[model samples]
Target: MFTKEKEFFSILFEAVSEGVIVVNTQQNIVATNQSAENMFGYNKKELETAPLIQLIPKNYHHNHHTYVNGFMKKNESRQMGVGRDLFGIKKNGDIFPVEVGLNPFTVRGETFVMALVVDITLRKQHQDQIQELNAKLEQKVIERTKELSEAVNKLKEVNAELDDENKKRLKAENKAKEALKKEKELNELKTKFLSLVSHEFKTPLSGILTSAMLLSKYKLEEQQQRRDKHIKTITDKVHYLNNILNDFLSIEKLERGKIQYNPSQFKISKVVNEVIYNANMMLKDGQIINYPENIDNYSIYQDEKIVELALSNLVYNAIKYSSENTVIDIKIKQNLDSTTFIVEDNGIGIPEKDQKNIFKRYYRAENALLTQGTGIGLNIVKSHLENLKGNIYFNSKENQGTTFWFSLPNKYQTKL
Candidate 1:
């Protein structure tokens, strides 16, 4: 029974990607999964029967023991190393940073604690480097002691060099900041995705489920047509679900740096036609897409798929935000060195304050808070256009309308 129980739980325990270590009431490491073993550079055999303190830094041992005893006496579990930093010692005696979460459990009248450990060395290093850079920049200004007139004249060049250095340092720091910012964006994306899926997908999936269930009750020939209607609804809802999944998949590809530009020569009209064709299914009653004239004869050398995506998103946004019977205008124009696409709509324009964050992933304006959207469409559009060496901007008035315009370089290039 003991072996069976262990085997049953081993799957779940190992399934956790983070390192997990189990320690007895005496703080002796009793068992550890592969992640824990690998993280600390210690095997299961080596970890078993070893004092837990061996894994922690020597300087923290006293406080660690006191905290453990207090936790034991309380018979409750709380987060370990809260309000302060924590360090872990690897098998090779090299100390590294870690974040630990502790939970206490009892089995067979004996109490044991489980620790979930995450190695945060990279996070710590980035933090330290940013701090060091900031400190150096501050020290440079504080150490200047010459008179103001002479210093301003003589040190102007040095200050300019320092300014350049500061910019380089800031650029490097922004990389780290981008990582953290992306993490926050992803977390917020999950929330928005869940909300969207719950509200948007649920309705369609519920329709599919309901239609499938209702179809079984029909047996006569007269009911066959009704059953066919339900089947069509199911099929269309399934297709909608596929599109939702595709959007999420695109986000995953973007995050993983797997989206490569595969630009090819294609006619601009082809992109607009495909976008409008696919988007026609989603149009509201009396809604119309006004296609620009003379577009079909135009040619451009760019990624047709990307242009289709951006145009589709903008058109959909126009439709979703505008009331029934509104016209969405699409205009394509070519200048001396670039081709521009404009999507204009008489919809509820974005608020001025929200314009700055319109391209931020999962950011929705106050006026659009209750609107049915994932808030990732513009972000994806902007990202794709930027990758294709294009620029996007918009002009909007709160009650009037919005005109989104973007231009791509007019370069003849074959597929990469």
Candidate 2:
């Protein structure tokens, strides 16, 4: 029966496609399948009882014993040579890449290890071919990525133009026709506003792109200041774009009657500080904001977000219309029924004729038509204020300056 069992083992082992070699505790080859003998360029019975090192590359011989000893102690099955390449030597001394799996077992109180080996030269060659193909395609991949980015930017610009046109068309259709002359004036304004929109978007987008390109050139530690300058330009451009988008959204909400005011008690200083912090980023050379005095103790029981938005529009407008080396003053006056916030700037102000229509939607002053503005911020602010029992008013003189002020009720009583 023992002889029959040994014969059965031999038959099964030899049937395996991979090379198999069994080693004793002394690291001598105890048995080998025909596949192992053929793989190592040896005849039948040639590898029996030979040192396992005879089949390993010469450089690996020094550490082979330690590895076998560790594997024997662990006495488990696992793949050999993880995270590294392994090689085998043939009987004629030809070296080739190989993958190896090891299994430890015991028979008749003797410990032995079985090594399963597979030649991997073909797999290694395939991997090298794939890497070479990737290297050749790298430049094409980069060009394609750049083309995709430019296409996306162009799409954004087209979409913005379309959105502005749609808004204008909708507004014109909704308005009551006072006279044919007024309708003709409205059409002319729409055309001019469309041109302004194009200029406004393209100008900042071009600045952002230029700044971004310049930023990549300033890579050295010593060029940090240059990098920061470009970074600031990008940031300011992005902020301006965001404000325009917010203004559009505000217009849409107002037209749809979807504005919802959520009232909550909040410190007035908190809102003031945020507005000044953001405004500081847009300050011209030698310009400064004169922050309101000692309002840290004041609180407001109204819609904090609306108040902040109204304040931000006024402060931003003051900054935009102001000149270099100027001061913008912000003052807060709290009373029993309402609180008034003031933003005064020494810059281009509304013309006497444009002052009456300043709060009208999409109305830019004749003197300020060339400036970068959407002309909807004040309209949105006024609408929000009146809806919440507040009021907004301003005083201006052409070529002098402007002071815009808005007041909100101390405790808002919902009208909707």
| TM-score (all chains, Cα) for each model | 0.54, 0.53
Q: Which is the leading candidate under lDDT? A: 2
- Candidate 2 per-residue lDDT, tens place, 159-237, comes to 9889999888877866645456678987987886687679888999999999999998998999999999999999889
Question: Candidate 2: where are CA atoms >4 Å away?
Answer: 1-189, 216-221
Give each model's whole-structure lDDT. 0.85, 0.88
Taking all chains together, the TM-score of candidate 2 against the true structure is 0.53
RMSD from true fold, candidate 1: 41.4
lDDT of 1 at 209: 95
